[model samples]
Target: MVFFKYPEQIRRVMYTTNTIEAIHRQFHKLTKTKVRFSKQNNLLKLLYVGIKNASTKWTMPFPNWNLAVSQLAICFEELLDATLDL
Candidate 1:
């Protein structure tokens, strides 16, 4: 039997996803006043800038991603193994 002993790691991964999502929501809140960006290019420019600024935050690896991905792959192995599971 495969044993996944790292509950904290799983929690950390979940927490990070939540935290990043919260930050994204904050960005939306902060930009809610940009209602005048009616043109597609103008909105795209704001999105581009937001993404560029957020990209600067990747200073380190998400600690459990390597193991978490492996565990997840194993959990969904049958789905992955099937040729047309999607």
Candidate 2:
């Protein structure tokens, strides 16, 4: 049960639901600011658009793909390649 994150911008990844809650805060903001929409569908549209925009600027995967895959194969060899058919 270990996790690692890059040192670029976001530091340690906490167990708490902080990131999701932060996004939910944006939804709350939309409901408050954009009052009196003609119908419920418009509210849904606003929330969906806001989340889509936020996700676009998210940080990318860790750059060293090969190294990570190799380490994982070694660590979980029993489950990944457990049999020898050939």
Candidate 3:
């Protein structure tokens, strides 16, 4: 499979979709507790606060991030260069 062609470190990063799901779960929990919002802005504010709080918990670096970056750099050198030029 194409996924297995990459190093293990890169594969781990690719499969770790739980982080996004966790954020959604947290947002759901925050919004679920409050059934009513007086305004749309209030709901937005609650989600903003939830995001801020969730960001704090993400302070740790991803495991083997350096290795993953190196692998990605090698795999997508041309794409990376194009992005960097923009």
Q: State which candidate has the highest lDDT.
A: 3
lDDT (10s digit) by residue, model 2, range 22-41? 78887887787665899989
Worst 10 residues of 1 by lDDT: 1-10
TM-score of 2: 0.47
TM-score of each: 0.54, 0.47, 0.76
TM-score of 3: 0.76
- Best prediction by TM-score: 3
Winner on lDDT (1 vs 3) = 3
lDDT of 1 at 81: 54
- lDDT agreement with native, every candidate: 0.66, 0.61, 0.84
lDDT of candidate 3 over 1-86, digit per residue (tens): 99899878778888984688879988998998788999999999999999999989888778777777778778888887677552
Clashes of 1: 0
lDDT of 3: 0.84
Residue 72's lDDT in candidate 1: 51
lDDT of 1 by residue, 9-83 (tens): 555666576756855775796589876766878777777777777767655677757776665556566765564
The segments of candidate 2 whose C-alpha lies over 4 angstroms from its true place after superposition are: 1-11, 15-17, 60-86
